[model samples]
Target: MLKTAAGGSFIIEDTTEVMTPDQLTDEQRMIADTTRDFIQGEVLPHDEQIEKLDYELTVDLIRKAGELGLLGADVPEQYNGLELDKVSSTLINEKLAKASSFALSVGAHVGIGTLPIVYFGTEEQKQRYLPDLAIGTKIAAYCLTEPSSGSDAQGAKANAVLSDDKSYYTLSGTKQFITNAGFADVFIVYAKVEGEHFSTFIVEREMEGVSIGPEEKKMGIKGSSTCPLILEDVKVPAENLLWEVGKGHLIAFNILNIGRFKLAAGSVGAAKETIELSAEYANERTQFGRPISSFPLVAKKLAEMNVKTYLLESMVYRTAGLMDEAMREMDNSKPDAGVVAAKAIAEYAIECSINKVFSSETLDSIADEGVQIHGGYGYIQEYKIERIYRDSRINRIFEGTNEINRLLIPGTLLKRAMKGQLPLMEKAQALQSELLSMVPGRKIEGTLEQEEHLIAMAKKMFLMAGGQAVQKYQMKLEQEQEILSHLADMMIQIYAIEGAFARTKQLIEKRGEDKATIAIAMTEIAVHEAFEKIEAWAKDILATMETGDMLRTQLSILKKLGRRTPVNLIAKKRHIAEKVAYASKYVV
Candidate 1:
């Protein structure tokens, strides 16, 4: 029995065991394969032309994607969708991301722009809008950002004045930098109502006084259509209101959460694409009479890129599997279904935010490295890395900037702590102790349990000090957003490690120990590394807040105490790359 911080035992098992490819269901593999083929056969060929904003060609391809069941993956079958689980959706997004900025357009349309309606729309709204959206009859867009509110999407000043008869709301405002703006048939617009709360409305393109301005030339993702949505006194019927009035934040937050996971998945895709490109180029482009990939520095970069991709892949599917399984435990058919649904879904926001932060940063770093390996050829537009570099830039900025996500990370986890959503720190510690007993390695030594204790302490510190911290240390908190960001990442990795470990235990019981060896290796590496990171992050956090030299002394002691087993990462990465290459797909 696994005990939590509060000292209760649960049936949850340690999941740090290894898994093999045969462990994945056929459905999972099929969706991943189909997505890979789509990118290689379809999008890659037309990428350059699409980057030029070939609107007609892009729409045509989008329609083709609809026909291929690439769009509306998460929508229910009753609503003209495959009704695939979140894992499938995540896998698709990861593969698409390999195409780089093109993946951003795909993600925005399928994830942020369309998912709100799928999750929260009325039956009438779903019937009227989703079939076309699912089948790509109409492109979809989300209009939450305004010229004034970049990060504060809820700060929408676009006012929707209700008519005296309560029949319609006249909306007149502009939503800026909207993806698929010029091409979408429908939009989920956020606006403020007079004497009421901020709300979301379903605004159709055929409505009166609706138009899209010229596309804004962006720093990246040129293939995507982003423009300002001009709603000049557009009168929307009261029935067009999505979900309940004043609950627009629900739609926004839930959809954005899913978007974060998909973004992580997509970034994994981009990283894989970048890796393949770099690998091929390295083998062909020779320097010092050998392929550039043969150089130690280039080799090191490729290895690191592969490691990052593998970790991202592990985190994404693991999170998706958890989401899908959790959703299955709920009743999703009630009118108030999404409320309970939100509870279950919202529990994983920490995971989603972590995926967003780590995957985006990994993609950015991988793209830069790919360019460096290309040795000047990477700078030229002739090389794909230049565009990939540009396209990868906006990922960290959008889908709730990493800054906002960082705060949400600790904030969300703290909420879960209060609600007992996670087992108490003591329970988590007991599990750690049990794992250490089973593995019995030097990596398990040196203040691991203490580090976990510090994490719990940190959580308590934040809770006790958070309000006052915000008031007295607002500027300091803002400046240390990076700490929150790193802590969020550490939390995410910890969750993934824990969950994956539990899953591995299940596999071992059902399929025997031999079959789970590889997963065991992966989990061991992941857990130790994650522990080190969390240890470092927690220490830094403590040190950062301290005014005395005691922090430095404590951190130095902790650091010396927590030494780990050295991994032959190069060998592990090569092994991973070979498997992915053999499948000719993104393995994670």
Candidate 2:
């Protein structure tokens, strides 16, 4: 029997259910356990030497992962893949993150590097490329980043000129910082076509003028190949072109959105690994004649890390599950199904960006504290914390920098909010009214009244920032981006509080109202604290818009919101952490 965990249904042992092993299906659990065993037994022991770029060992491990089915989580059944859904694929990424750089290599191979063809390729292309990718018979690489086109990838300088016969595209350009460039048998190369649109082609190692430069030393993930791909008039057959002409951006953007979400899932894995490592260390390291884990400060850090990790994991799984459900409901056999689905996938750019930013920042904070908990050992090469700290830093820099993601959140939300697409603020109003009704005379402070005020301020800010993204090179979206990003974050906290309370109410109803003490208390705390924070942010925005008497009026509302809110969040978080930690992983 299969057992499911989290929100997914699966089958597992009755005893394991008590331990909260619901986050994984039986198949996923087996794969994760296998990967974990391999990492501990094979990878961790050689992690130091591998970080030095031991090519042979790295290649061998890639083969090992292939043998274990970690390399083809997304491939179809015919191509030797498990044909799993996005949630299972995310589960694989999470498992791989336990090993740091090794996970990056594996994730890139299965994610951004190879997914374009899997999602958009013709039957012939799938027949030709996916098997090798699935079995690790040949390495794969994604070529998009260039020296000048970091975030501005549309400004690709790589020229793909059509041949006189129009049967081939002569690709000429350099792709910098390409993963697996040194050994990849195939590369998904994107270049600007002569007619003004970007195009994608599968550039094989056998192709003439296809060459890789010596690997550039990276800040981290050194074991994975990273170098420049030079295609000097490399001719790729017309059949090799991915999707339609001028549609490379669609493929690139959509695939990257999926990649970003998976990256968040991977970061969640790394966070869990860091927490477990730190916990193990703290339990053994003595301080004041007792384990350091006994110290209040150290325990608090661990608790905080656990709570954030649980939060991130919950978000990742929820997003992935939603994506999987959407894909399942789509009519994939239809001629336009792929294109339609891709568009819908891109619609989640905001969700993916939010997850990416939150997960990466959370991992960075956890890894930093993981190091702190290890004392002197963390900074030294002898411990994995040193590499984790280094490897985790790149998560924020790549797959669209967090700065880019931050802007994406607010910009995406505002467009939807203004169009009456998402009723976030409206929902917030209703919740505020409900809670206030329950706690009479609470003086709700910056309630719906202030939310309306901020909405106007947001509209003006959007106008001042101009709705355009400026020139192809300028980042004029910065100011609007900051405001929107901050607003979206506040919105997320508000929604989360509402959700927590709603769940608590449901649980109380199901299990009998008397048994809902902890859940009720926690939900109350979450709502009040979130209200206070939202009010503060709303007032801050108002401050910038008005002055003197008007500012004082707005500021008073914020102070009132903060006055006498019930719920002690510190205690609630401690309880939440205790619940999650004892549940093994991702229980809350």
Candidate 3:
């Protein structure tokens, strides 16, 4: 029998239930409204001051958010934290994106900086740090990237040596691009122990010889602290060592997984805000005696922005649902709870990467269109979209660059298939057999039928391209970064198509087809656009990987699978545009 949801399971199974904003409980909604109120009532009023990098003001805002229990969602209650579910935490971040730079500060502290202790700290360590960190009395920063290491984390040159009496470890390292460095009271620093084993240690800012470099003048997200931490033989107590020695990869990579997901949720929030700003601007900005929103060309941009964001929002929350489910039974008090939590979160590594890459790109593209919609005013700093445009650029680079994430999507799947943890090989084999007898243009039935069939074909397209790639390259497929990236694109599109389709179905189920008319239109547009990209990428992969009769055969199968029922995106987009324009905000 097929199992319940797991990482990358959507490729094999149909998702019947998903968590959407519509399904959020009243309490979760309240948390969001509270955060929204805080951002609007407190943060935005200080826009100029924040933009000026007012350290005290930024830290004060974070402390206020902490007082509201906003920073403690991922922390367990035993440590004087809120211990909310993933959905609630996601909502908080999403609403917090109303202030982008400040959002990054809060996200870093709540996610990467502090989650290490929440999930991996010794009980004593948690007792010493969790309460203060949770309440924002003490800010925390993550230190992993070094001057010599960026994507290649293990290449870090930082090291720590224990004293002969074993009382403390003398840590020496420079941590690059550390968020909250200026105000962080605690630092989760990584160094190779005994000059060999990469490990994590909790370092205090007040520790002797600990220093912070001047802030980096960034192009955007400037309000958030971005500085380097200088540890000149800082003495970190032996008890401050996190988890076991040499297990730092577990902490670094696992925390990055959550960081990616939270970044995804934050992108969705930013993208939505961009759409709201774009829609309102297009409606209010007049062109040639008519509102720009009345123009079909401008309306089309609004529609695309609105629809793409809808698709991303669906996926972000659904992934959150998966995460919450995975950790539902966790016993945080268990001595091995950290290991257990890490394993549970690691299971969805692929999904988290997917969410990260897609959401970041979605926000970028939407931000671009938002600027275009704003015309020349977008270039001026006075406009919110200008700041948004700049701030959005950092997301792709923040939680592992999108290129790194793209490579991970397919590479991770192949690794799992080789270990029998995933059924990729089995499905690829089955797809090849199906291609022999499968006819092109087979019609699917029910609401959103054409979109549904396209999703099925997209999955087959992935297997066809992937199966041949694996057969040819074997273990060396890792070297084919381009082909692997293409395969990852297929996986992304498949997940995205299915995400939109599932959410639309839920909308129709609850509201009836009559009421979910705009949702269907948006899903149709997103599915069509995504499938077109999938077809192009598959052909690109086939051409690059094969030749002669083999290449021709693969293309032939792709053609059969790529047949479309012809969605009228122009009409659908116009309809969507009207919906958002009327509300002057992004709607379903």
- Which candidate achieves the best TM-score against the true structure? 3
Error of 3 at 371 (Å): 1.0
Scored by lDDT, model 3 comes in at 0.89
RMSD of each: 5.6, 7.3, 1.5
Taking the tens digit of each residue's C-alpha lDDT, what string does model 2 give over 492-545?
553233334434444555666566554554555445555666665666555555
| Better TM-score candidate (1, 3) | 3
The 10-residue segment of model 3 with minimum total lDDT is 1-10
- In the range 1-588, model 1's lDDT, one tens digit per residue, is 212121111112233433222356799889889988988899889888888888887788778878889997977777789978777787788778766656766777788878888778888888888898898888888999999998888778788989999999999898999998878888989988873578899999999999999989888888889999999999999999888789888778887888888888887778888888787787788777977665666766776676566666766766666576667756656665545555556657777787888788878999998899888999998988888888888889888998898788766654554577655444434543443234323333331233333333333323222322333454466466766665565556555455445554556667677675544445545555666676666566656665567556545544543544565655655555454334433443
* Candidate 1: residue 10 lDDT (0-100): 15
In candidate 2 the C-alpha lDDT for residue 205 amounts to 90
Clashing pairs in 2: 2-10, 2-11, 3-10, 3-11, 3-12, 4-10, 4-11, 5-22, 5-23, 410-484
- TM-score for predicted model 2 compared with the true structure: 0.82
Highest-lDDT candidate: 3
Tell me the spans in candidate 3 whose CA falls farther than 4 Å from its real position. 1-3, 440-442
Whole-model lDDT for model 2 versus the true structure?
0.69
Better of 1 and 2 by lDDT: 1
Q: Clash pairs of candidate 3?
A: none
TM-score of each: 0.83, 0.82, 0.98
Tens digits of lDDT, candidate 3, 1-588: 112377887887667677787788999989999999999999999978987889899999899989989999888888779989889999998999988788999999999999999889988999999999888999999999999999999888899999999999999989999999999999999999987899999999989989999999999998999999998998899999999899898899999999999999898889889989998899889989999999999999989988888888999988888877888888877887867887788899999999999998999999999999999999999899999999999888978999999999998888888888889899999888889887655556667888888898888888888899999899899999999999998898888879889888989989999999999999888889899999999999899988999889889888988887786788999999999999999899
Question: Any idea what lDDT model 1 has?
Answer: 0.70
Candidate 1: Cα lDDT at 462: 30
